[model samples]
Target: MKPIMKISPCILLLLSSFASLTSALTLTVGDKTSVCAATSLIVDGVLDYYQGTTYGGTIGLFKDPYYWWEAGEAFGGMIDNWYFCENDTYEDLIYSALMNQRGSDKDYIPSNQSLTEGNDDQSFWGFAVLEAMERNFTNPPSDQPGWLALAQAVYNTIWARWDTANCGGGLRWQIFTWNKGYDYKNTISNASLFFIASRLARYTSNDTYAQTAEEVYDWLTETSGFVVSSNDTTNAYTVYDGAGISGNCSDLSTGEWTYNYGILMAGCAYMYNHTSDTKWETELEKYVNGISIFYNTSNNNIIYERQCQQSGSCTNDQRSFKSIFSRCLGQTAILAPQHQSDIMKVIEASAAGAAQSCSGGSDGHTCGLNWGYGGWDGWYGLGEQISALEIIQNTLVLQYDAPLTNETGGTSEGDTEAGLDTNDVTNVNEITVSQKDKVSAAIVTTVTLVTFLGLSVWMVL
Candidate 1:
């Protein structure tokens, strides 16, 4: 049965958002009340599509067509909304959702979703915890693992899959051997590991994390050739989809994405901030420039998925890419201030267009995918809500504080070995076995031995 959704009343909702969220979202850029109201409505749209499995859904995920990983991505954006908008209307729900999904291993790889998990899928939660850490979202109690530790847990386990044995070195798209894309070393997966490492290095002041980020960049540039465009006229280089190790990562998939360049840009910006290295600064500039391919000039520089959006063929997952990229673009701009004006020009235009697109769906505020299509593109879902919310909220990014570090006021705990003891070790290609199964095997072995001994004795008699 299709679950009937209800519109959340906006009484005493987010700041100055007393207006009902069931109406179209009208925004006045640079006005706090308007931005707050707009984000509040979009956030409501976000929750409307997600009841979480615990809230009476199927299999611990968001609404139909959304993968489990997108839940993490949506919450990560919600945390950003919490940071920028200062609305805790759904704080408890968000926190509980994150904690509940923090698998027994606390590595974002829950037993239910582990069968088809990918490196990028796992890293979505890693990105979420990293967002919590950077945003200083409410920390866990004293004895519980903190957000920083959880992010590291994801990093430790994910980086463990760095397959040096194939195509020199890189992370495969899928984690398990049986999953379909295990042989494909995709950019989003590798970029995720790099993004996490660079973010961690900045937070923990750890040179080791920075080194890993560098090695990841080196592998993509040298081994995979996915980082540098085959036909580069400018210093710009688009991050292609990725390559299969079947051809030694030489036969590139060549699908460019907003998140690929955006993730790399943010990671490089973090690297530049952490080390003050000009090389990282150079990389940052190139990546930021590379993102230009995603924006259409005729559409007044509004971003779109060049590979799929033109044909209106984007998947549910692809629909959410802009939100992640928008968040990262804001981070990159703030960290690399030289690019702030340029980045905001693009973001601000898209924000206005996105606001206009929110006048869709039954509630009249559900966001649409085609920001440049003038008004509503008629698309509405968790992905559109997330992409719109993040872009809208992040227009206020400059007014906020920069991401914190351990040397700064960050209070999140750390555990370098968080995932080391878990049963879901990435190196082990087999499915995880529980302790109960081990005990059952032992009992069966003992009973079989006794039966064999009795049969031998009877034959002897």
Candidate 2:
């Protein structure tokens, strides 16, 4: 038994609460069902699986993207593209734009040339053609494609100048940072881009693209430690080099940290799935375990308590939605199912913390004015919420149907585990997932409508 130490009134109150729950209080939503199980039934709308869009109506974050990126120079070029402007569907358009930006290169013309007309954001416009071609093998539409095409076109033009040396090397500015006219590359972002590109290759079955991504991955892992810069801590890559706040890069540490590792982990997992190489797994586990140090406590409470205090400076602190969401999103990168439940708990709890901070309750799926912008026009707070809900939906889809398999019939571990044991009666603490009840009801409604509309349209055909 631990001795009770005297402390501040607030600390005493908090401690008392901890003592009250001597038995680990399982958060039950009712009927002793697992939190994941309860959340499973609460899908508000259908998700566009290929893209992370919600049906019924998108929350604030996915609604409009261009406006969100316009505020920041870092993402300015990428957001202003034809795919984003032309496709009115909110979530998909933004996702498409992000994908194009992540995979962009110079001299690489998008097969979809028309996507970049009438766009004023010149920096990212040119890359559109190459990016679209690389991903979809389709050209831009005849319509007035706005920001998406223009941004992509610009990125491609810049990428062409990138130096691919020694198995794989990245540019200094344009390649990884999207900054124009400079030629410096950081190992972290380059690794991140490579990871995203590799996943795209796996999804699209483009061997050449996959090979390029693999080469890039090889270079980064072989030459660089987790630390991207010499000044960075041992074995850890700084998110950026320019600013102390970003660990290895610029001043804003929020942009660097665990989230980058998460992206890299997910990418490596996908690469491992396609290449059948254990190296990817080894790398993934390293990052997964490495980021754990930042956790506030052994129980994962520190992550919640610290929230968005990356590297001490809260440069872009107003909207914690993206930062928190990144942490939760990273949990799904692991290929093992055994760890799913534990990961889900952390993701769900983090999301709940976000909602609890903003709104009084955990059921905050609806978007409103208070939700601040991040990657898209809608509030990142909402994006955080959507991410959590989508995880639940994705898990269910995998459980009921063995989806997420590679073309070679190899089972991808992506969906192998259903975390949180939604049906487990003994493991409480899953009550948070129950907050999704209304969202699930909305999903049922949307499905019914879609079914009716599809049948009607089919009959006419």
Most TM-score-accurate candidate: 1
Identify the candidate with maximal lDDT: 1
Tens digits of per-residue lDDT for model 2, 181-231: 233344434554464455445544657547767666665555433234324
| Whole-model lDDT, model 1 | 0.82
Range of the 10 consecutive residues with the lowest summed lDDT in candidate 2: 368-377
Tens digits of per-residue lDDT, candidate 1, 130-242, equal 99998889998978899999999998888888888888999999986656788899999999999999999999998889889989989887678888853666678768898
- Which residue pairs clash in candidate 1? none
TM-score of each: 0.87, 0.46
lDDT per model, in order? 0.82, 0.35
